[model samples]
Target: MSVMRVAGLSGLILSRALAMTVDFTQTESIKKGAGEAAWNMVRYYTGNNTGDTPGNLPDPYYWWEAGAMFGALIDYWVFTGDDSYNTITFQAMQHQVGDNDDYMPQNQTRSLGNDDQGFWLMAAMTAAENNFTNPASNQAQWLALAQAGFNEYVSRWDDADDTCGGGLRWQIYTFNNGYNYKNSIANGCFFNIAARLARYTGNTTYSDWAEKIFSWERGVNFINTDWQVLDGAGNAGTENCTQINGALFTYNAGIFLYGAAHMYNLTSSDTWKQRVTGLATSITTTFFKDGIMWEPPCEATACDTDQQAFKGHLARWMALTAKLADFTYDEFMPLLKSSGVAAAEQCSGSPTSDWKGHSGTACGFSWLKNSTWDGNYGVGEQMNAMSVIMTQLLSEAAAPYTSTTGGSSVGNANAGSNTNSDNLDPAPITTGDRIGAGILTTTIIASLLASVVLMIKE
Candidate 1:
């Protein structure tokens, strides 16, 4: 009996030792390096550098890619509390929203897909939550734009479609490309934004929408019984039943996981918890091989521009899940930390450049790719690397981000009311606790080519 007791005590001691030894290396150099990489990508976008263009969409001013960059900037701000990019973030938001709080669908030649708009909306929602500074005229108005976007989805909900039993279509109009597809990303965005709105406003309507979206996804088998989230169904013709594409993209699981986390946070319901657990488990078991999360198709060579950007979203939400959901924190922390380290190490330790002086390390798309960038250094790659690093820093720092006092008044209080069917006001964009720009812009024109882009097919 004493020997057995000693063995049990030894096991307990070992467990405690391992718990205390969680490997978290959040160095200033590492964080600063990530910030520089992000800025490098931003400079590339503005046409100030000649390293590599974003993707098939040569127009640097594309809204969705810009949204991804903004997301990376937000993560950096949250992790380091550095306001270096505050002006850029503010300016980007200013240009993004139209006079009526609607996102102007202007991306050069490419038609604005629902997922593209949804990405910007998701970024706006993040800006609101993190107390990021906005234009004084639009203070606290991020939620209003978010609501307007959400309302747009609510209105566009095609209940008449027998194919998927009512979900948002990928394209706004039939004239635009991808109109026939009902994708995971489009519905996932709806679920995510609705869940976030529910948390922020404490409104049941948003929760109801969240629940309904999840149900539809489940009913259509897009989210399988095992919780594997497949790609969308192509609505090419009304004659064919909705066919599940079955390609497991990382971002699909990402938004769904985040939405589930938010729902659990807002409602404290066991169902949401179960959903969160199931989804996390599915992502862990189904998505990852050899303990590294990867989008399946691009495991070998370079992923397409869109798929190249997908893993960043997965990393972003996985970190969020670790932060927001207690059930998954313990499980995700080590994975995230290790993944971050692997990603950073894979980046070229020194910057590369041509004779014209454009210089930066291209982070390889695959985390498993332990070499320097063999492909173009576009917006997606930069965002993906920055995202992984910043998430790691934030997780290690364990900062508490509280909402500021003056910015709570959403431009449209009726956003949650579901009654303001009319035009949305030019909501508040107030300033808050943010860093002043007095420091320096020495890094702005440093001339490095970092990477950034998406998949066309549903």
Candidate 2:
């Protein structure tokens, strides 16, 4: 059958499949996809034989990819009650901690460009603490490694003179590249990792550092008067290929969302909630079109570039958006599935096709032949996107329901109150809930609008 015909059939099948059952057994593919994606990422990062050419080894060995994958694995295990995903994640952490040779000897003590390593370390630590029951589970070892890596990252910060305000410098280089400009995405990741570490270890120092960096980024470089993030404060007018001037990025936005969500979880502060909601709303309004999100230009001229090329970033932001929006499994599931499937389709015949690529590995896929960008295949973008998607999916699947006091409930406080027909709030969604409900809602609304137009025509 034609691709369009297949897509149509898949859409129909997805629409009808989850209407009746609320159980997780009904949506095992999402869980499995997340697990598989995480495993693929770990394999890719470890340079395992996936029958694909390896992309350029990421500086610091792409620990963020590993961290995010493990994070997703934890989320998957929580939702599906599957121990295997958790087991693999634990093993990956052990590999990182026990095998000191994972990093090159020259790169080991150098923390200058180690932003991703810290982020991934924290992710592994969180997973180990949450899942591992035995002392040999190495939860403590992973946490220590993450904490040490964080300390090394902290040392790279120039406290005396806040050049990029108070945020950490972009990287540590032996010979000065003279570029001290802090990147939004990197700082955002640092803030997120620091904040989570603070909460995990009961240490206020890490949290304070996270807040300081977040404040620095918000106050100095990115945040506009309306609190929207600009790409950066550096090189305002001149066009730089590496620096995308004044444009907001979906990945950067996702990092901020992750930070904000963690902040909200830690403090229960309304400020964090408002910021997250505003950013999320801005993202939905500005970049999202036809259920796909697009990346903002790295430069003014690139603004008109084909939006389809940025699907990886969109997928990442979508997962973050779902988390912040508190979307139920039923609501966001189809979108997740569609996004994953679409992205996977893009890399289907390429060398990186073995894994989801977008979320499971560190590289970029070759753009289609007719596209503007180079078709050079890599897995970094795909792996980054997949990690977030998987993490969100698993988290939703594993969330526990709490009984609502003085309410007719199935012991799941998040389960929508069936009686409040006038209340237009979508069902309460936790991180572990499936995205099916949100997708269903979107479908139903679209169908109704179509029917209304048909009636008017008749």
Candidate 3:
């Protein structure tokens, strides 16, 4: 009995070790996992240039969701140095853009919303920044497309309105429901693209536009004193009607965060630094439960498709801020790491989950570590999980493989050396995590007990 007990205990320990051991050192593997997930999504949603079939995306296929998925693929290519997906990226770009590949027509592209157009432009900007070589054209062509997109936004800026003084409308279409809605997402996306373009091309025009947009947002009180970005105000028939809507969203925070990070990196001004830190603090305090992030309105119930997709931008930009801004990295790493690990654990047994670095299905939508899936698995869910995994993998790639004492290190490698001393582990483990560990132990023990009984009978 004593020997059986020891054997069972050993089995349990092995199971725990297997469960906990994720290879942070395997950069290629990590990139491949993320990249493949994006690839799988593209295959399902996007098809060959042979024209639109029942299986393929229809002609002029440019929407916010499709743009985001394409952006994820481009990010995967840039981060991993894998060009295998570049052909697919450009193929979609060809389908969406005008004949010159620079002008994205509102009619042809069906880009009714400024925010929707911004998403595609941002992906183009990323490709230009990374110098993604196109077989059909050059990097200059990609830059031209980005500039055209920017020019489109500049043309659409509604300075004539007295409500916010100056800001873009949610939709360029007059008949759209959100036409009267001056949303943060529109301005935030505009701000981010402007900042990124400024950094990429060293164009003061882009920076100036970014500054103007930021001021407009501040003026409207959409971005409050606490750095919490409210949703937006609409029906502003007059300046007196400038009451800002207070509903918060994660993507709004994310867009501003990344935009501010870029501007800070560009100028290194104290003001930008303060803005970056203030927004970071607000995001952590407001959106996170303990250390994991949740969309507040959607926590109790399943998030709508768009809301379900919102958190991915937050995850991506927060991680980007950590990578680009040294001052905020320490502050942001704890939540990023904890949430990332929890997300990974929660995703262990997801439908079509390809966790073993092999071909499988994409990850599920809910990222609350243990939240139940809302039964809507689509491109958005795939993009969200891909973004998080890519961010975590990049964090791992930045850390040293081994410690000075040669001791096996745990936690996020980029999370600084004196983690304990820094008191970064403020996150309380979720009950789900504890229950998950307990289940693993019980399963291993039961299997070992059955084996021991068989031996005794023999």
| Lowest summed lDDT window (length 10), candidate 3 | 449-458
lDDT tens digits, residue span 58-174, model 1: 443355777767766776787766778777676666566755565644532246767888887888888777767755763436777788778877777765444355787776654
Cα lDDT for residue 407, candidate 3: 20
Clashes of 1: 22
Highest lDDT against the true fold, candidate: 1
Q: After superposing candidate 3, which stretches have Cα over 4 Å from the reference?
A: 1-29, 53-62, 99-103, 106-111, 135-140, 238-241, 348-362, 369-374, 395-458
CA lDDT, every model vs. true structure: 0.64, 0.43, 0.61
Q: After superposition, how far is residue 323 of candidate 2 from its true place, in Å?
A: 5.1
lDDT of 2 by residue, 1-458 (tens): 12322332333322222211112233565455444444444454542335522321343334344455555545545544667655555555554443442111233334334445544554544443443432353233544455555554555554323243245544444222223335665566567667656545545767777777777776664754455555543311131212323556555665666566556656767777677666665655554445533443422122212222234444544454454446323444455554444333332222323332332122223222111112223334345334434534545542221112111111111111223212222222232221232333334333323322110001
Backbone clash count for every predicted candidate, in the order shown: 22, 40, 1
In candidate 1 the C-alpha lDDT for residue 114 amounts to 73
Error of 1 at 41 (Å): 2.0
